[model samples]
Target: MSDESAENLIAVGVHVIVKKHNFSKVYKVSENGTLMLGKNQKVEMHEVVGKPFWSTFEMIPKRGPSKNTYSLRLVERTESLNDLSGLKGQLSGQDNRLIVDYGTSQGLSKDEILRLQEAGKSGKEIIGSLIENSTSFAAKTEYSQEKYIRKKERKYMRFLTVCRPTIVSLHEMYFRQYHEKIGGLRMDALAQILCYSDVQADGLHLLYDSGCQGLPAAAMLNRIGENTSGHLINLHPGNVPQTAIVQAMNFPQELRDRHVAVNIYSFLRLHYQGESSMLDNISTSSKKVTDHIVERSVEKLNGETKSDEVSRTDTDISELETDAGENSTLFLRDAEKDADTLKRKLHEFEEAEEAVPVKKPKWFLETQRALDLLNSSKVRGLTVIAKEHPLNIVNALLPFLGASRPFVIFHTYREPLQETFMELKQKRNAINMRLFTNFLRSYQVLPDRTHPDILMSDTGGYILTGYLVQE
Candidate 1:
């Protein structure tokens, strides 16, 4: 073929009609590979040629035993010679429907045209498909000049191998589907869960897991804070292996003393089996809890009494003295009386505090710290895995949390955990908490179902999923 004739042929889109040697067999190529057409069914290709060829037909069986005895024949050619400059000029005055028709005539689907309009499908993809299949469908007319299609096909195939899935599409598809099933939780809930559960108050305890959902969760929590008045905290415990301590030190000053004391003790009891002795020592000696309580009580007493004169009376001096005189038998009787009197005063203070229904200060501190961390752009949401007493973790977290909040927790086949969750629904305090469970092996959430705000998995291990809430 003449150079100009070859070039013209290459520029046109090809239509290939392949007929089988035996009427019993039929074939066609698609994105998924080759499919055997039904008997008497013929295979036809439309709008196939451009610079790169194989885009017109996907290669089949990346690696497998070769089948050499295949009958292949290409029997028709078609060319697309639309004037782009003229089309562009006419686009403004012409109806969109008419332009779409023109695109369809050029072998592009409506969806493909829309994609093109959106700049999704690259120009190369459109051009490549046209070139590769044009030769096979070229007719005996002047526009049907023959040329080597294999060279172009090989080059296009190489391009396909290097192409990566578009990130925009991947994220859109993944999150769209994820939200659809999960009832579209806001980032605030996620941030709150992460900040409170994952990040400790001291900011030294960091949760490490392969699937990081903190960023999204933190984003959600921030939104929540704007809508309501609340605090959030995020703690990151650095280096798990070296800190056999798991550092309850990260808890807020108040929580470190009371609420977390109990929980941390439990967590340590489970985490360190043979080393309970070490945990015991830390738990008993770390006056952090007492200090927190003392500070909180002092604050409350200060708030109740307007004058600073009574501040000294609110001090736990008697308790301190009792503690200091523990070794002296002679002072024991005096210490006991002082201790009893101090205990009564403390009980009265606690009762008055309870009358106001203030939340456990420690819980609030822990939750606040967690929320703060989640809000930080640098940290993502956390994954909480509770191997023992998953319900306790849930109870501990749920009481301090707010409504329409985002948090994910998991539990195994433990019937008690499920029962506990069911029981939580009865309490007015638990009205805001939503729970979901996945018994299936797949981690994927479907697009149609109403996904739980919190998803629990029965994989025999309790895990909290989703982003951390930031405040």
Candidate 2:
């Protein structure tokens, strides 16, 4: 890609879902093909490619009578965070309907309604027509009448606002949509992990994520400002790690370059295979050592044969090759000033070819590189989020962390983290250890009807966090 071409594009492989609300049918700007807007209108990749992030682009009809083709225009942008005080007193509720007021009105036929919906009428216009054609419209109470209009509006709504994707959106898309696969971790829970770990640019952090294609890992990447200079040594149980979530984040190649993956096998080999004495305090029994060595060799052998699988899961280079894949590795900045901030963060990274002793490679499981990273003494933090028990991992890895380095573990059930907390207590290797869960409450905001949502999430998962106090 030329420098001129790169300047005109937004995110290439990243597909932003265009929808009015979370429940609405989403139209995605993906590598699959042109998006079909309402009335069979199609939007090409080029139409969305040049648009700015967070800019709301609407589909307006051409002057001529072609309903299937639309011209894209940047109309406005809305901040995700906005004051709700101005949106109160808008809700209306009613008990019963009145059938006496609309006895003689003639409603439109079903065929007429279908025709109007297919005619590309605006959402307001269609709702108006529906209300006009419903003979019982006047019979409903004011609250019911409002609800009817709202339902019709949602049905006819076609316009969408394109916003920049972040951890909030990812939380909505993955955790809300596929909870079981995502390990039931909520946005606030992940936020707590980042906060407790003190994630920032230029820090070296440890992460273990196997759920939702590195969902936690992707979020950590987002929090660190797309690896301006920070480094994340991602440790996974298997040789071929699932990295779909991180790849979906659309971070720049420079940012993706900051991520390094290590298999538990290679890391154990370096940690306990007589390379260092970190594991010396642990049981020196021959049986345990023999079993560990056997496991490591088996895992390492299995990992070496997974090159093809690793490429499919970890590398985003080939992901956007679909018809709409722009195939550009550059990341788009929302503003010049944001780019300046990232540049300053990356000054140290730019000056040095390798910030950590372990060099980052394009592949996921570079055994030698993984070993080097595991042995590095500069680790500032560690985060564990997995479906399996985290205590075993914490015990094995905490010995290498520098004193005062913090770590966090996330679990849907408190039992796992609770057990890990107790183990830390016994060893006296952690300080300020605490186990807690977060509850999230949301509200329904509208013009004069804002109130708390009827439902709230009871669980944001359990967090057991503490800092390492190396013996």
Candidate 3:
């Protein structure tokens, strides 16, 4: 073919010769346009398509006029082609022009294609990196791989760029799912289990697996020490495992001496038995103290009531009869006195309740810890946003709730649990319960509202949080 013709025929359906040395086995194009040959024989042909971005394509066999008709040669070329012949060669005889054009139309670039090849990375990785980097490209190519990596990676460092905010959003979405649908107990239990599972301790430092896509966990952990009271060291993902050991070793000797707590969350596991034991002791002691206080309060109230009943019964025989004879007047006086006494008693009880130091509910406390860890200097928070999930809601409010220190529960719209939130609200005293709904009007109308001790948000699937607001 003439050079001009060859140039013009660059479009699809062009015919070309195979470079013989590239393949050790001989193969020929079949009538169906697939490659066919002996198991041992091989040959290289010009790719009419492009590189395989995701999957590998295998050549198939076809029947022809000759007994050895497995092999065939192209006799002609077509016009309307583009210059993808070089890429076609690199992609093992696939249709380079077609693939390249498709990718280009989707916003990929030649340089990106090269980088993608050089990195030996998957399409998913390339796409993720591009989005995370927020590469600037033409509108069509904003999400296109070719425009982002080959062009953008040169200007931006993926690791140096900020991804924590987006990751944090995602984390919020996941927690929302947990809080709205899974219930607070399950959410706390899952977090605790994951945290404990990830813990790693050595003589020097403690390492833990903050969990997959850990930016959110790290952000939450950092916020714990700042917003609430806790001692936790947050670690970044890249420096983990090694940095964990270093931190574990270099942890403040003073804190250790004072029996202060040190919590670490990463992918590594804690190796020291002593540290694990310390954590267990703290958990056990706290639980014991709470139980004892509750038990004592119940006993004291019961004792007080029993004594009052005995005194009232003992005084009244003939006096009660005389009082009855002057019944109307005496009864009115006594009823008024009783009402006054009851009012006084109610006021006293309320004051005592207010004076009682409320322990934060487990979910709020744990979530606060996670938020503190996320905000720590050593770690950066990554928010994860999902379209729908309970975990997302929980993660989002975790910081706010921790600040407010409110009790939380999640109830769903379906099954035996249906309308359970409404029932609980009606049954509980107004002071003890507070509900926050997505319904905008309800949020606006409620007056005399103190910040909820228990803050609840719906997952659209269910309601979360019940009981006294902790803050």
Ranking by lDDT: 2, 1, 3
Residues 103-219, candidate 2: write the lDDT tens digits. 555376767766775666665666667666666666566656766655655555545566555567766866656777788777778778889988888767888886656788887
- lDDT score, candidate 3, position 330: 55
lDDT of each residue in 1-471, candidate 1, tens digit only: 677555333232222122211111111223223333443222222223332222223222222244311222222331112311121221122122322322323354556544542443333454454533333222222222212233322322211110111222222222444532222222333334445444432322223221222233233232333323233333222221111111211222333222211223333333335334544544444445655776676655545443533454466877656653453443445545655666687678656754653333343344344444434423222233333445554554442333334345534334655665565555533334434443333344645544554553323233333322323
Local error of candidate 3 at residue 169 (angstroms): 6.7
Number of the top candidate by TM-score? 2
How large an RMSD does model 1 have?
27.5
Q: Write the per-residue lDDT of candidate 3 for residues 288-321, one digit (tens) a residue.
A: 7755665675565556555754564577787756
TM-scores of all models? 0.25, 0.67, 0.22
lDDT of each: 0.34, 0.65, 0.33
Name the weakest run of 10 consecutive residues (lDDT summed) in model 3. Answer: 157-166
Q: Report the C-alpha displacement of residue 245, candidate 3, in angstroms.
A: 18
* Candidate 2: stretches off by over 4 Å: 1-11, 23-32, 35-46, 55-106, 226-228, 274-365, 445-451
**Residue 459 of model 2: what lDDT?**
84
